[model samples]
Target chain A: MNDQEIIEQIKKGDESAIDFLYKKNYRMMVKLILKNSGTEDEAKDIYQDALVVLWQKARNPEFVLSSKISTYLYSVCLNLWRKELERKGRHTSSEGMDYGENMPYDEKERIHIVQKCINELGDACKQILIYYYYDKLSMAEIAEKMGFANADTAKTKKYKCKQELDKKIKTQYTPSDFLD
Target chain B: MELQEKIDQYLLDQLSPADKTKFEQLIAGDSHLKSEVALQQSVVTALGNTRSMQLKARMQKIPVSMASTGNALRLKWIGIATTGAVAAGLIIFFLTGTGQEKNTESAESSSIQQTTSTEISPAVVPTIESTTPSAESQTEKAEQAVVVKKQKNTGTVAPSNEIKAFDNSANFDDIENGNVTTPNAENSSAPANTLYTETNNKLSNLSVTVDNSNSKDKSYQFTGSKLTLFGDFNNKPYELLELNNKGQKNLFLSYNNEYYELVWGQMKKTPLKKVSHKETLEKLKVINP
Candidate 1:
């Protein structure tokens, strides 16, 4: 069933509706939570809380659909994961971690080398790059999250970071450079 | 754009299709551009890989804290409106007590007991201003205004309104009160009663829709939870409907103009039972009818 249909069934207290929802999104939810520094249990807890929230909102007649269910779910999971990180008093540097199972062998090695190069680059460059690319956060989100002046400022910083990375890579040339 | 600018735009997937083609052509013809593009790409790829690993490793060490105290969550909700109601009641009790005592003293001091108009006025004001009793009336007016505005704007009423309760405030009040009432005052409540009063009645409609869906044919029976609608902890249990459907099931519950949906799946049986969505009507429903 579509999300709306499932949501309708769930409102009526249908058990199967809950089952179907869990099955469809559990894998992606787990992956998302794990990527946000959540363990398997944390992922499960956040996912469960998200489900309850969904259920509560579904029962509330006032809430209108503004986006796809998956997007909403992902947003909730992300928020919860971020909260988890904050509660632990740890800063998440999700930089240089390989979570993409779909990466090709050559691409993976090249990526590793590029990551090393980035590490060699300044910390500012690394943070900007991670904020923009790996997090897939919008310039606005990044600006707000990182305390940038504005989206324009964040974009400028990102541009400078990219330039620095490029400059560093040019200085250190290797034929099998990607393989390192 | 400069070569660096073009390369940056290309890496970010911001270049137009035509620009992308031009850039690709330029890179193919020039070994220098190719090398530059490869180097830039490598940096991005490496960052992506590193971030993913970091996130994964971080997740491994981190344990999920409970978002809320689950033990309190269910009961807390069950008592939500009741807590509010209890608080309001206490405030009213104190105010009325003080007012009555003052009125008695005034009567003793100066024989003015015909009405005690000021004292009575304050007591009534609290009842009205508390927002518990008069919410329906205000909600009704707001809904009417919205309907009129929508009709004027669109020149038509939506089809869903045919199924939806036109008198939302009244129906909400009735539902919250636990009255087997229908939204239609003009049309008899008999039809809606048949629809909601029996498990068999709702099943026929749900089953027909489920049977027609494209999924594989499978029959399963599972008990559903009904909303608890009482203030007192002790109340007779009401049996919830058992849903047997193929599609992803979501149970929608409405209370006091608010709506909630509960979703669960792959369950041997329903996990949650008789959750109150924190509505005053539930208290009324259990008490009045």
Candidate 2:
């Protein structure tokens, strides 16, 4: 099947699609992990993780496959291995590292905090914000998916959700907490 | 427009050129505005991360039975073949030893045969052969070899080697201050060097194409990893711009005419500072060059 068709099957939770995806990409994922100092068992773990990530993306109504499925799977495995390497404190020079590894620790922490606050926004606000910002859904689409009266209603809901989210974050964290 | 809407637009890069310039001036002039924008940008980012994490959690619960059936069978075959090879080698060793002993005639010839048998025996035969009185000892050695080979075949030899590598490096203080010989130092570096070369090749060849026109909602794929950017506009179907990153994470692609800039970190098209196409090209040149 074509990429779109496969994606559609995955979205519908087709077992065959999942099987096909795992079968097709498992070798590449295993090879990647093995090359990165992981064992066959670890490769299996990483490949499973990558597949889960792909499955998650496929299940999301908002997710679009920007790259070939194999490419996307390969990227996921690479990132997982990089993170694994970092966690193990086995990170070598940039020659083998991925780009943007130098993101400030403080920034990462701040993003983590904001994510916690977003999660606390409850499912309604969370879905709306994700659809609007991350998914880049138009107001009309958001309204339709969210069952709002119209686009304007979705806009108002989104505005309020942002306000509520901002308030939650500000109340929990001071500006210094993030800056430091 | 409300301040929040303006910030959202600014973060998403939906602001007009004039408004974008004005927002930048505001950010530069006011620390509070700068922090507010920063906070807002973080919220957008957090939302993106939260979504990814949630999806990951869900994906983990998927049944392993859904994995390819062929893989399981292949591993089984490998295990069986390894077992057979170990058994075959043991049989050959025994057969050669018996045949040689029977063929030997004079004292000198017998002595030579004994020497040769003793020399080659230690390698395939376990140390227990000399010490153990029980016949079970032979089976034990064979089993051990099979077990070691099986573990090796499973690709699990790296973790111990990795641990050893770390331990050797950690003892550098001792090595520098004293004349201690580090046996594991060589063992550690061998795998790491081989792994590095192999990883580098795999990483360099890894590429993922970002389709600008695929999804109605402008959702970008991120795998929460470091990324290197490579832009290619000449591809057919969707305009292809490759993000050659280790893991696909938090990339936002903006399509203008035929040009595409796959920005790292920022999930939205908007950056706090205005970035012209010329600046983007310069950035790509820095990355690729």
Q: Say which candidate scores most in DockQ.
A: 2
**Per-residue accuracy of model 2 over B63-121 as CA lDDT, tens digit each:** 33222323343344345535555555566569887533322011111111110011112
lDDT, candidates in the order shown: 0.42, 0.48
The clash count for each model shown is 44, 4
How many residue pairs of model 1 clash at the backbone?
A: 44
> Candidate 2, after superposition: displacement of residue A30 in Å?
3.4
* Clash pairs (backbone) in predicted model 2: A66-B211, B13-B270, B223-B248, B227-B245
Per-model DockQ against the true two-chain complex: 0.07, 0.11
- Summarize candidate 2's per-residue lDDT along A1-180 as a digit string, tens digits: 445766766554444555545544444456555545567666666666666566655544546655456545544565555555554454333233322256787887788899888878779999899878876677987898889999999999998998898789889988666543
Off by over 4 Å in 2: A4-24, A34-36, A39-67, A75-101, A175-180, B65-289
Model number with the top TM-score: 2
